[model samples]
Target: MPVSQQRPLTFFGVAFAFLATMLGTTLPTPLYPLYQTQFGFSQLIITVIFAAYAVGVIAALLVTGRWSDQLGRRPILLGGLFAAMISDAVFLQADGLGAMLAGRVLSGLSAGVFTGTATVAVMELAPSYLKRHAALAATAANMGGLGLGPVVAGLCSRYLPDPLWLPYLLHLGLAGLAMLAIWQAPETVTRPERIRLRLQRLSVPTEVRAVFVPAAIAGFAGFSVLGFFTATAPAFMGRIMDVSNLLAIGVVAGLPFFASTVGQLAQERVPLSYRLPLGCVILLLGVVAIGAGIALASLTWFVCGAVVAGIGQGIAFRAGLGEVVAASPLTRRAEVTSSFFVVAYVAISLPVVGIGVTARLIGLQATGEIFAALVALLVLMALVLLRRQRRPVMP
Candidate 1:
């Protein structure tokens, strides 16, 4: 169990596999506009479709949250990859909304299985000397990969021959490669274990509550940033800004995620105590920019806001996660992480749907300003709470 003796290659393999899985979940980000055109759906419908994916994620977290820790990381990951492959196939044959929804549902399940399982696998495989780096790797791989997906898809959609088919086809290839990688990677868990399958409710230990509250709040705020881009940014860019280009839409929509990736990279340098509050304040600035973008109807302004806000989200999120993981027992780290994800996904799902409703009633521009302001308020409240906790206690 020496720190130096752990196999770095196997550790990397686990990280890469998880990264691929997360990428697969977001691969469809740019394709939503195409789907909307093909299916003739409205903004509300699109949100519903995106929310369906979140629902699948929550369902998997509740059901299999603890299964991977007990059953072994390889099995859970392989299972997740299998589901992702199925999801790609579903999209490939997608002829209507039903097929697309099914594909999204499967995609969500794949993420649910992979997220917790892969994080544990990476840590289990890491060299003891690199244990702290292992945590950064987990957050970076997950968030960074998710950010990369839409960008990749956007490039392919614009430059490549086939937009829809090519992206999914590329994903299918990546997923296959990941499968091979996983098969060859080392298994972290010992055998002779019981596997239980049933609905499980989300829970947190009292010891973890302090870290959990701030972490979950940060997750909520960060993922809401993601939701704005993934769920609605494309539509806004194309329809409102008059930029109907696929690549532009994808890049603008993907800005926050990529910025977040950068933020996570910076987490090791910034102490956790400062990361949360500072991130919140920076996020507020990004929100302000987004609101201004909507008010001014400027594409450049909106994209700029996404980039700035994305960085704050990334910093806060990684710091929050680090705090929670530090306090969680290794035995149930994956479960705790899954709980964190469940909160994040809720933030991703509901608020974006609300925006969709607003877009329908008020207008896309107005809705954008409204959502930015609301999320800004939420981040402000979280900042106040986190600062209060950081204050000294009276004797």
Candidate 2:
């Protein structure tokens, strides 16, 4: 069949595949408390578990970032879905920290592969008329799946037959569906006659450096806030605010991700040069709100902060991504995008570990305040750097 005939069914199919893989990455967010209770671990353990996934992502990215550009998008993405399913099965059988950590690492591998490969695949599959909007659609699917995971998991854990097992089972089913859908979707990359495996290198080209630098910093800061919420916000809700409902915690945890989608949408109205700085400004404000929430012990303040941070992160994230994609050499696009995400996953993992360490020492409230302050500092730095860029990235 002609590519045009396959555009609608194929494009959306790959998008859904992207979403399903991302959903698996965060499926364990709300379930952390359950793991803590059962395993009797520390706050640091939570960060470590989450970080394990990020580490897996970085590892896969280092190995397979450009695989789609060589072996084609379809096969790499199929490998990603298979990884996700394996992670779910691992989670289903998890008995202690080791198994859970292993599961998360596998999940990370899945996300790492998908993050670059799937994003590019969705855009490649878009019909000509929808081309301009395809990038946003891909990003929305990424953030939306991430945001929705905890919510769906929360609900299942709260009311389902077995809290621990049911969510993974449900996701396992979704993974199966996504795989079937993607199997039918057309491959966008032309397969080379000779396929050789090469590790992804981690350097930015000279031209992309200006945007890459600020974008990585902004991405780091925005993702730091997101990491905190996903890893430990439930602890705050349960301990600081006295909320015990799993559903509520999941919903709150997901707010930033969903808000990020909104931010991405709003960036369409922003000028090419102003988007990153504006996003940093919004992110800094959100950090303040989060600090306020921590100081006052107000759930309302915390929720407000999350929404603001999400929006800021979304705007900055998309802006940085757009600039990088635009600036990259055509053949090396996926590789460069992978390098960017390596920074992001690093940001998501390390800072949250710091939160765990600080929370353990000074307690959650003071620790949260300090985290907010640190994030704000990074955002300001990014804003300054963005202002100093010599050449504007042209789309």
Q: How does each model score on lDDT? A: 0.83, 0.89
The candidate that achieves the highest lDDT relative to the unseen native structure: 2
Q: Assess every candidate by TM-score.
A: 0.91, 0.94
Q: In angstroms, how far off is 178's CA in candidate 2?
A: 0.8
Off by over 4 Å in 2: 1-4, 206-208, 325-335, 390-395
Model 2: how large is the Cα RMSD against the reference? 2.8
Worst 10 residues of 1 by lDDT: 192-201
Worst 10 residues of 2 by lDDT: 384-393
**Mind giving the per-residue lDDT tens digits that candidate 1 earns over 226-342?**
888888888878777888777778778767887987887876687657987878887889889888888888988888899989998888887788788889987767668778878
Clash tally, candidates in order: 1, 0
Model 2 TM:
0.94
Candidate 2 lDDT, 311-337, residue by residue in tens:
999999989988888999997786788
